[model samples]
Target: MKTSQSYTESGYTHGHSAPVLAAHATRSAATSAGYLLPELEPGMSLLDIGCGPGTVTLDLAERVRPGRVVGVDPSLEALEAARDEASRRGDRTTDFMAADVAELPFADASFDVVHAHQVLQHLQDPVGALRGMARVSASLVAVRDVEYRTMSWYPDIPGLDKWLDTYRAIARANAAEPDAGRHLKSWARAAGLEDLQVTASTWCYTDPESVHWWSGSQAARVSGQTFARQAVEIGRSRADVEEMRRAWLDWGASPDAYFAMVHTELLARVPARR
Candidate 1:
């Protein structure tokens, strides 16, 4: 579990602000964890690392009924929100805790499966984190993350390009990889995980409602206090941040607006015990 030091050391770019939470609350198992669904059974204990609002965790819990589901993160606000979500969903079995990925507070082979969604990109030591995951997981470890640079949109806006560059710079400054999707294989190999299977997926937002929601939320995220403050700390002016917000809003108003984010998911089996 995360002590005060580990929690304080986590350089999560998107703080648990309303905007960030709102955006993350949309995640579900079908949308984010489909690649791992086929392998999940009704009685496999699972650990969700970096489970933000517990939306996806709850969905995954539903898939593994009667099996223990625990979601862990370093953010107290996020853990509270996750607990609230679990309660709202009437799910009594799932548990939420504050834990660091680099030092998972679990014994070896503690869970049948370990999963993380859109998490590796924000972590400073993803390889170390994977090693911890491999240590705890008895059978499988699943992870998915987006390649920020692979994101494509319709009617390309200049500010969107600037947004990508600025965001990448800020993430790198935090010692995190903004394009973590492409590195999962190498990280898993370095962590000594075996029998790796990798897959790719995309979230396409073309419908009017989806486009509007995605764009507006992104605008809020870029203009939010956490990102805005970090941007400035990394030499990005307020004007630059405003341009990113405007670009998202402008894209939302376009009748032909489209956005697709590419994600990579990896499932690796833990090495057998002697």
Candidate 2:
């Protein structure tokens, strides 16, 4: 079951397949940025790390109009998708590049604000990535990540627990923390960031439109996404994965179905130059 690629070192355990990228493309700045949006100002350079599909990155470009904005990720395909999105939006201000979080290619203090959304959870060395971010940020660093263990759904369907357990196992096997929300502050401290401000938020899907969208996305992910393949690699059978997919669909169909996921957000100030 060993593939040539090592998922542990890839940082993104959930490989950027089509379904995953589609899920990411649904995220918008208002929904994903949390507390970071209020901090943006015109004429401030911004960098978004692991900026998948550039949906949020384009929103940021609008916010920091007349300023520099760049989105960076390790996947060239993701970057290409992001570039296409920028083109579709007719946005010429934003730029997308392929770069690693642990070793950003930009010079030190290159940006006024650096942000990452749902990025740290996938990294085996999140603190190392933060250090690199801190190096490039002149004024601030903002991040938000989910605590997957705190995810909850009502009217749970059969095999839902198994699905959660399998996902946790796969993430651990990749040396990534599935529940990264609780560790943002500690990781920030380890990265030597100062003047920290931390907050919590929740993304709740209860309305029919939201629930159906979220559930359908998860169903596809568990059925054919990289995580599903990794689950089999870790000993879960294909039948089990299919059951999980059905469970997601069943949950989506329930009359009283609801889902909520908790996230932690933080804004830390990078120390001024000596």
Candidate 3:
């Protein structure tokens, strides 16, 4: 099958209805992952940066139902989508703000728990963005991201490794972080964030029986298509492009399709006395 035919047209750009992308986005927004938000209290303020579709925003609201939660992003589409979702959930305490993370409009020290997930990897000045989030943040800041370099690869396919490299090269050309886990910590520390800690994890694609495979397939396909597109634009031979695409596709089907990637949880404090 043609790579395009096998992959969704949106290919995880921003708005795609692919099952894989939807699942991954949903997981990022879940409240179960809110452990990093230590500043969250019954009546404390919370902010979600790049709050795509307001998943994390809603999650934050649940933590501080009586308190206020704000979700901010530059994309009106994302803000509207998040609003629509909030409306469906009847989450009145949560509000969506259309703004840039790099330049927030909020007053300094306004929020207790400022949370941003999967947003830093795409930024030009990730450190600057972290500083912006840290500035408006009251006491605590937490950001989560993946390390593409540590992305687990178990298949013994010879060509697959080369394809991975090619795919990564193309991704960087588009001004996106090909590997963001290690960079997340550096950015946080450079932003003058103290008490920084990094927690790493690996989400794998197990055999067909593995419940995560359903979601992993979407990620693999989206990432694979991204590589394929870059390969075409970068003048890689069509055969080489197809080889990489196929490896990624087969990765999803293989019983041993387990990839380990690094993740981080960065924290800092803003003194109330200061």
Candidate 4:
């Protein structure tokens, strides 16, 4: 998802590039949204904010049959891909729209559940985004984000550290929080949401297939537009970006390479009507 409202910084950090979308399209509800599955019930309306390519959104729509499921993103390009994915899946009911998390164009209490994945981290005011989600959610609000600073990998590869540093700098330059997983609880509380249940999950890439895809996509991402472009804008040299891209490729080829990303999930219930 992309957000350009209520912020002075530049647009989405990753932009709407092919590599970014390819990486995001691999996410599924089972893998990315397992924590919220137990709470899902059929016939419940859902609003997926920042639903990027809508891979998870489409999977989620399957769980809530005969119910409305809408995916929203500030990036029209992302929405177009999402719509195309829906069409490919032969899903006729799911709807994709262009909207920012800062100002959802929906009535109060319009959805049974409001969810966002990897979206809040990109917002300058995540708490404000949560408030908007809470306003439109009658029952629950769920969100997930990764803490980039804690991401770990084995076989201490060269240039990886530089990659992390440069990525963080770029995100900060855009006024987005790269390490946002740890702050989900605080953000939700600050939004006045109550009954929060927080949990943690990990995405490990050690298997051959997983490692290849993860590393290749990252290399492509850093070498491609947006990330690479932003790194230069933040005083990093093109040589530094190229080095990181090479590092990712090297890591992918190593048999002992392992990577783990930590994500925090928050499930909060909307306060009862007063």
Choose the strongest candidate by lDDT: 4
Clashing pairs in 4: none
The better-scoring model by lDDT among 2 and 4 is 4
RMSD, every candidate, angstroms: 2.5, 2.2, 5.9, 2.1
- lDDT by residue for model 4 over 75-168, one digit each (tens)? 7778889999999999999999988888799999999999999988888899999999999999999999999998899779778999999988
Give a tens-digit lDDT track for model 1, residues 119-164: 8888767888888888999999999999999999988899999999
Q: What is the TM-score of each candidate against the true structure?
A: 0.96, 0.95, 0.79, 0.96
Clashing residue pairs found in predicted model 1: none
Off by over 4 Å in 2: 1-11
lDDT of 4 at 91: 97
Ranking by TM-score: 4, 1, 2, 3
For candidate 3, the 10 contiguous residues with the lowest summed lDDT are 1-10
RMSD of 1: 2.5
- For each candidate in the order shown, give its overall lDDT on alpha carbons: 0.89, 0.87, 0.66, 0.90
lDDT of 3 by residue, 23-66 (tens): 53466444324446455668888888877677767877887778
Which runs of model 1 end up more than 4 angstroms from their true locations? Answer: 1-10
Error of 4 at 225 (Å): 1.5
| Best of the two (1, 4) by lDDT | 4
Model 1 whole-model lDDT (C-alpha atoms): 0.89
